[model samples]
Structure formats: C-alpha cells, structure tokens
Target: MKTLPALGDDARVRLSRQGGFAAIHALSRPREIEFAQCDISQRTRICSVLEGCLTLDSTVSGRGDQRFYQIEVNYRSGGQEDRMVLKVPEDQAPGELVHLWDTGQLL
Candidate 1:
C-alpha cells in the first residue's frame, strides 16, 4: 500500500458495504459538492480518525455470511492526486467505521 499524505480538510471518505445488501456513505469536507448519502457534519470526525492510516496495518479477511467494508479516502493537494483504499471483513473492522453501513451512525 502507498503511504497517505498529510490530509487536509478537503479529504473525503467513502464507506461501502456488501453482504446481503449494499450501501455507501460518504463524508466530504468540500461544502459545495452534493451527494445523496453524504453527511457533511461528519467530515471532520471521520477525517481525524483516518489520519495515520488507521485500520490499515494488516490485511483483513472476510466470510460470506457477514458484511464486508471498503473504505476509500481521496484528496488532491499540490497538483497531485492522493488516495487510500482498504477492505475489511465485518469481524475485523472497527466498530465505529462499521456502524455506518448498518445504522448510519459514527462514533
């Protein structure tokens, strides 16, 4: 995996899940952009949690009966594009990050 740059407020995080159903929730800091599943207020919180590559230290495995999560982070800085993406099984993902797929809540 590539190292993530020091992210700025413009950073964006998308949480996607799959198992019996599919869903996506995005936290985007750029105020003007509009996306249905986006909850702007959570942008700062999620971004802070994502710093230092949280939850990316090791590879995660999944089972068919449980939900799996894909976390994608994106941002542009200094004329370059930088991003980090990871997939984690429900059993291994952080509780707060997984909550969004089920209850649309974050801690």
Candidate 2:
C-alpha cells in the first residue's frame, strides 16, 4: 500500500466503495484524497456536502445491489486530530466526491 502524504494543518478525504451483487466484500479498497491537493471547486463541493457530517459516524441503509461508500476524513489542527466516518448509500453520496473515487483527478 502507498502512504498518503503527511498533512500539516490540512485535511484528507479517503473514499471506499463496495457492496454489489458481483462483489466479494463489504468494503472495497479505500483511496486517499488530499484535500489541499484537490481543485478548489472540488474541495469546496466535498467540504460542503460533508459539512453536516464532520462529526457523524453513521450508516444509511440500502438494497443489496446498491453500492455503499465509506468516507473517512481526517483533519489536523493545533496539533489535534479530528476524524469522522460515514457510510452512505450510493444515491446519497456526492457526485464530485464519487468522481474522485473513480478517478484520482477531482474534476
């Protein structure tokens, strides 16, 4: 596994997509996205969508074939660490964020 770059007073968003009729596991590999490295608009969209979820640790129910996405966020400020995790149904995930998962480029 490759290590994500260190963040100093910055944030990171890691997205994991899994769960499908043809899938084997409940969760697929997670891709780490450096928040500061993303395009301004992408970062803004992600931040806005997740703004209500910065402190939430929950999951949304969905059908068997529906994909599940696990979003892991880590933030560091003032030498303190803040973390949040959210597993939501495919329809509930933001398109911009999902695009980042499908492709490393945040467009």
Candidate 3:
C-alpha cells in the first residue's frame, strides 16, 4: 500500500503500486488503476485536470492469460463515475505506475 500526497484541497488523495496491486480510498469512495505483466510492451498512462472531482477504474493484464498478472489501483472521489481500460505487454516494469498528481507543481 503506497500513499501519495493529497491533491490540493477537497479531501483528495492518490496512491499506486510498484509490482503488484494497489487500491485508493477517499472517505468511502473507492477507485482503481492497475499494471500487469502483459503491459510490458504497452504503455499505461493517466492524466487528470480536475474542475470538480474525478474518479477512475483501470486494469492492465498480460496477453493470453485471462487472469491479470498484476492489479495496481482502485480510487474513488465525490462525483459521477468514470472508467478506463488499457492493455500492456508483460515485460514493462511496474515502477512506471508512479506519477505526480499535478506534474507542473513542485513537492
């Protein structure tokens, strides 16, 4: 379980996994994004500019195998629902999942 700094105000937070699976929770809302073995060759990425609250669910899986080799994130916010799916290769390292909430800002 990895915890990222809160995203500005409004009780928002971000989290990610390195080589396994990870989940994120805000209050009671839950959302997710993941990177799997098959994702090795595929590039999985996310970018968000929030006007309100944004929630997402993403999954990455290995090819040929029905079971995803890895599960990365699950997150939820205080708003409507949004979802995304990405396919990646099995050689990519999981470290790629780490990303700054607001890239333009300095920590």
Highest lDDT scorer: 2
Candidate number of the best TM-score: 2
- Compute the lDDT of residue 19 as modeled in candidate 2: 74
Instruction: Report the lDDT tens digits of candidate 1 across residue range 1-107.
Output: 55556555566666666553333333211122112244656654565445533544345433445556666777777867777776666566666665555555555
TM-score of 2: 0.61
Query: 1-107, model 2: which lDDT tens digit per residue?
Result: 22223443279877888677777653576787776677677666666656643333235434568787777779885688877667667766667656767775556
TM-score of each: 0.55, 0.61, 0.23
Error of 1 at 6 (Å): 2.4
- Residue 16 displacement (Å), model 3: 9.3
Q: Which regions of candidate 3 are displaced past 4 Å?
A: 1-61, 65-79, 98-107
Q: Which stretches of candidate 2 lie over 4 Å from their true place?
A: 1-9, 21-29, 39-42, 52-58, 62-66
Expressed as tens digits, the lDDT of each residue in 70-101 for candidate 3 is 22223334453322223223243232332232
